[model samples]
Target: MATAAVDRVEMSEAEWEARQELAACYRVFAMLGWSEMIYNHITLKIPGEDGAFLINPFGLHFSEVTASSLVKIDIDGNKLDDSPYPVNRAGFVQHALFHRHLPDAHCIMHTHTTAGMAVSSLEGGLRATNFYACNFAGQIAYHDFEGVTVRDEEGARLLEHLGNKRVMLLKNHGILVMGKTLPEAFIKHWSLQRACEIQIATMSMGTPIEVTPDVVAVHQRDLHMAQVPGGAGAADFAAMVRLVDKIDTGWRA
Candidate 1:
């Protein structure tokens, strides 16, 4: 397999590690059917680099994203690197807003998978009727879709809806999640996707059985308890990275 060598001449070890993991995430998303051709995004800030983040180049499929190929940009979306690929303007702006305002939001992922989109389009976004949904209980938030999220004003409103929640369903648009680390953000997206898939499947059979709030509370507690050791999904994300290596390691470039 022909792969481009990542030029690490000027890259810090921490930044290189961040790129490798973030690029692996793109392949993981591809494997799980969570990609949208060349759209959607998953971004992680370069560790030890203030306000500089890494994003997938605009034209490649998720599977084609590579560690060295990810573009580095500043807070206002200016390209800080010499990559030939351009960044997705709207995606950068939208993701940059959260990364800029929230110090804890080091990684962000947005997706438009079929099931997630179906749930987002529903009038009753993300019903608390499944195990995965229970993880969010009262932690998920929703923003009314105002279009494609290109307008500058939409960023503020989106953040307002997101508030303190790590997950948000972009009504009629898609799902977005942010985390203090890449692993945490990836797992949240995985959980949300599972929850959305289950909700859609359950609804088709009949009226779904909505669990009690107490059940959700207990479920959430049990789930959060798992995070204490692995920094909110490190274990899960590490497993996925290994899977990506087995399938295709071109992302490591």
Candidate 2:
């Protein structure tokens, strides 16, 4: 197998901060045991309308990731960074669609958590049976299992499933969330994965579940409250960076 060579470049403050936040997201996922080796990806749109984004190289483990180690690539999945590591074609397939179709989504996150896979396997998929479940309500979208997402055909189907929504529970696969910033994507995923876990555990009780009325209205009101544009999510991201600093500050390397 051929390896893609990484070209080193100077990153501005914004770019570096993006990388660190993205890397922290990877580490947090790894720490939570959400990683499946190097198989999953969390991508952030490069700071321009150049149709380029940053993604992890194919070979490195999530724990080995660093801000400088991230590779820049175009929507076509071609490496703009000259990095020796190839970007995972499947990762690009889903990421490109979200970034290309959703103008507001600047960061695209995906994961293969245990509870996520469990939720994906169910018939209804992500049931709104609890408080956190109400967070998604009618907002969640589903993409049927289409094998691995390495082909162009899969991209269109995946895009159609994504529609105008911000989150997709890829049936029998994993979870993907998109946002305008790394913090938004990360926090959304955190909320989404928690919702899945909560639902599963609640269902285990084998008792009847009650759903809140006016779910769509609640979701609309909560969307702003969940990611207040420039508020708690941003602060949370900053705090996460500090947590990364406490242990694996090597991401800045």
Candidate 3:
């Protein structure tokens, strides 16, 4: 667990809050069984810094992440902090590409959960066969598989496939979600993960029925209207935060 904290650097109050919230998010993922050893990552842009964001230290489990332990880096994968932990450049290549191009992508989540990877490996992608899937009627995007190594040029293609959509299924890989805030990203990932799990269960049975396209569209419209107006994902995310805090508040340190 990168025990090289010689001297924790000073950060602005805004970055400190972002760090705390993002650290909480990592713990939340751990609590929900979304972590895969030391793999996968969730990154958030520093509040008042340009070209700088927070990512998990490469060697630590999500459960061990703390606000003062996250590694800060720029869009090019260069460390902006004094933490001795390394960043997994290969895993972060795509994230850097999207963060550089998408202004509203303040928080980016990448996960290879069992169900998420299973659904992504399927040819049909995420089937709109459940309630959570309906939320992304036409919102979800898909990128064809291109092996493990992602080049800078391919990153451009990835961006092209992502377009303006916030959710994407990386075929044969995993799920990627971006949001303007950490809470928004967390909520999207939860919905996507749940939809994948339900799809797996539904398919285990007989032929599963899918909601019609027209009905799906109506469902999305009404769902948007039903939202409580103010915060995008604040309520659900706050609830999860409370849950995680009850388990352990060490992440806030």
Query: Evaluated with TM-score, which candidate comes out highest?
Result: 1
Shift in Å, residue 119, candidate 2: 0.5
TM-score, candidate number 3: 0.95
Local accuracy by lDDT, each model: 0.88, 0.78, 0.87
Per-residue CA lDDT of model 1 for 1-253, tens digit only, reads 3334346788899989999989999999999999998999999998888999999998889989999999999998898877888889879989999989999999999999998899999997898999898887788899997877668788888888888898998888888999999998988999999999999999999999999998887787677655647587898988888988998878887
- Give the alpha carbon lDDT tens digit for every residue of 52-136 in model 2: 7889878888877877778888887777765666778888887887787788888888888998989998889987776667778
Best by lDDT: 1
lDDT of 2 at 129: 77
C-alpha lDDT of residue 122 in model 1 = 96
Task: Give the per-residue Cα lDDT of candidate 2 at 68.
Answer: 71
Better of 1 and 3 by lDDT: 1
Candidate 1 residue 163 C-alpha distance from true site, Å: 1.1
